[model samples]
Structure formats: C-alpha cells, structure tokens
Target: MEEAARAGRTLLGKRLLVTGGSRGIGRGIVLAAARAGADVVTCYRTPGEAVASLEQELARTPGKHQVVRADAADPAEVNRLVAECEASLDGLDAVVNNAGSFLPRPYAELEPEEWDATLRGNLTAAHLVTRRTLPLLGAGSSIVNIGSTVAFLGMAGGVHYTAVKSALVGMTRSLARELGPQGIRVNTVSPGRIATEALDEQPAEAAERERRMFSSFTALGRLGTVDDIARTVLFLVSDHAAYITGQNIHVDGCV
Candidate 1:
C-alpha cells in the first residue's frame, strides 16, 4: 500500500491519453505513465493478448487506466476515443500520439492508394486525434508526437513514411505556437531503430544486415529500446519540462 501510494503521486495526478498503447512503443509509454502515477486512458485498434496483458498490468497500478479499441485514423473512432478519455479519466493533462503506420515500398512502385493510406495512418491520424482531444486539455497540458529518425535522415524505401514524419515535426512546431498562449506545450520525439516486435519480425538475414550497418553508424554502438523512447516521453510531459516546448527531441543514439 505504501509503494502503491508513492507511485500514485509520481505524475502528481496527471491524466494522460495515449494512442496505440497496446503494443510496441505505445505499450512502453502506457506502462511507464502508469508507473509514474498518471491515470492513463489509451486506445488500441484490435483485441489481443497484448491488450489483455496490458489491462492486467495496469490493474496493479494506483491510477485509473483503460485500454479501448479505436482506429486512430477514423474521425468517428477518434471522437469516440476522446469521449471515452473524458468519461474514464475525468480530464486529460497530456496526450501522446504514438499510433502510426510504416509501409515501405520503392518510390517507383508505390501506388496512390498506398500513399494515401500511409498519410492517413501516420499524419492525418495525429491531426484528428489532437484536434478532437484539444478541448479536454487545458493550460500546462503537453503533447508528444512520435516521429522517426528517418524523417531527418530519410529512408530509401520509406519515402511516404519519412515524408509524413517530417510533417509531424512541422505540425508540432505550429501547434506549439498556436497553443503556447494557453500554456500548452507540444513537441516531437524522433527515434532511430528501436528493437520492437516489428524489428523482430524482419527476416533473420535482413535483421543481421541492419545490425551490422547500424552498429557502425550509432555512437552508442547499438540499437535503442522501447524504454529509451518512453523515458524521454515521460520527462516531456512532466513538470520538469515546464519551460520547454515546440522542440524536436531525437531519441536516436547519435547516428
């Protein structure tokens, strides 16, 4: 009970809404926020063991936590998600836009539909979610949009992905300027290659090739982990970052 009580005060009662919180980096953020004493209402697109497992883990935490199913790209679903966050968490003090799609294809072979899907999934989804959730957030609220290092360095087969991520950086700056008057802060967290389930799914040969390539490029001499991004996110939303806003923070290990 003492430890639970301590955990509940970590974020000083901040309520957070995290998109795509059931898996990968999203899962890491949800869990970390809960541990930091924030009541979290997170959304997932599907039901699976991952969602079930996160539900169980959050149950042990002190703050209120809910995992719901909502397609971040759909406006109707995003509205429902915002409503659920308001209903379940009372109000929102922070938002983490971590839901995005990464579809890699040669620029020459990319279809119009694929390009639209990638934009809707990565860029438009953030706009929709943020616009809808803005009403619930007030002064001192923070928003962190998850971007990729590819946005800066560019990836050969991921032109669409990189383009949308680059847009997020611009969006972050614009939103920060517009919302700063209200004491709201917005920023982007761009991560390099991180070891997530997606990374594990790569063919062994491809994975090894990437490992060898990234090792020489990164100053830290290895890839990042989900926690590497999560910790940065946690700080960005906390009071410690009160004076900071409209910044693009790269979590990539100096590549």
Candidate 2:
C-alpha cells in the first residue's frame, strides 16, 4: 500500500483528458493517471453503471476527475467535451485518443456505413479532439494515440480497423513534427490482443485457440492486459519522458 501510494503521487499537479474512458482500456488509463496524481477528465459515448463505478473509483484517488459524454465521431460533441474538460481543469497536460470501434466484416461484404463509422470514430475523432484541445495544451504537453498491432500486420477481416489504426500512427508522426518546437510530444501506443468485452463472447475452445495463436507469436507467450498499456501510457505522459516524442512504441510483449 505504501509503494502504491508513492506511485499514485508520481504525477502530482498534472491535468489529463482521455476519450472513450468509461470502461475497458480507457478506464484503466484513467485510473492509472488519477492514481499518479493527475487531474483526469474522461469522456464516454453513453452513460451506465460503469460510469458511476468509475466516478467512485476516481474519487478515492489523490487527484480530481471529471466524466463527460461525447461521441467522438461528432465534431460538435468533441468540441464540447474539450471545453468542459478545460473548464473543469485549469488546462490540459495530456490527451489520450482511445475512442474506437471495430466490427470485423469481410471486405467482400463491407458496407459503406461500416467504413464511414470506423474511420470517423478511429481516425477523424483523434484529429477533432486534438485540434479542439490544442489551445488548452501548452509546452510540456503530451498526446498519446492508442493504436493496434493489426495496423502494422493487416488483418484479413478488419480492413477498416487496421486502416484507421495505421492512419493514427501517421497522424502522430506529423503532429509530433508540428508540435515539437512548442515542447509538446506526440506518440502512438500500439497494443496487441488484449482481452476485453469484445473478446469475452467467444467460445471457450475458440478463445483458447486464439490465445495460443497470439501467445506463440509473442515472445512473452501471453496476451496483454489493459494495465500493461495504461502503465506504458502513464510513463509517456510524465516528465520522465520529456525527451521522448514522435515515436510509436509497441506494447505487445515483444511481438
């Protein structure tokens, strides 16, 4: 507990904002940032028990937290969310673009709506949120874009998801170049197969087979957890990474 407390205070006085933060990997990042003493403002598309539970959890931390509702695909909503966060906190020190949706439809049968939704939520959303929050984020600011390994290694059925994830890395590098002179860092965190609600519905045998496939490819012989990605992000946003920027760090246990 003492060691945990010390870790929680590592980011004292920093302010952060995360998108799609009501649950899953987003929730893990929010909790980690709060525990590290950063005032966190997280956004969700819809509210439910998870949002309330997150509020209670964040309240126990040393820093402050705010939860808002925003659909990343909507530019108006993204602007409002950033405004709300800026109003609640004095300014933004870090922004994590984590809101995304993935539907594995075969390329031969993919619909126009599916393609639009995937790109809007995954790629366009990051651009909108960052542009809106640019004024609030100043020198020493960090922006971490959450991507997937599927972007690097294209998946057979998730063409849309992989495309958007790949685009994000390009976006990060370009933004890093533009923002570097201002002392703001931009990077991408590409995670491997992480067990989440999306994967929980698979048959046990199928799941095991899939797990084994991923484990065989990973040097660590296992899948990643939300906490693993969260901890890596926390490190990137902290002062410890002051000299690091414009890089894509794969957190997939040596994939």
Q: Rate the local accuracy (lDDT) of all candidates.
A: 0.92, 0.91
Mind giving the per-residue lDDT tens digits that candidate 2 earns over 20-130?
A: 998889999999888888999999988898899999998887667888888987999988898898788979999999999878999999999999999999999999999
Over 4 Å off in model 1, which ranges?
1-9, 202-209
Q: Poorest 10 consecutive residues of model 1 by lDDT? A: 3-12
Error of 1 at 244 (Å): 0.8
Clashes in each model (backbone N, CA, C under 3 Å)? 0, 0
Residue 68, model 1: Cα distance from true site in angstroms: 0.5
Error of 1 at 5 (Å): 7.3
Write one digit per residue (lDDT tens) for candidate 1, span 93-138: 9999999887789999999999999999999999999999988999
| Per-residue lDDT of 254 in model 1 | 97
Instruction: Check candidate 2 and list the clashing pairs.
Output: none
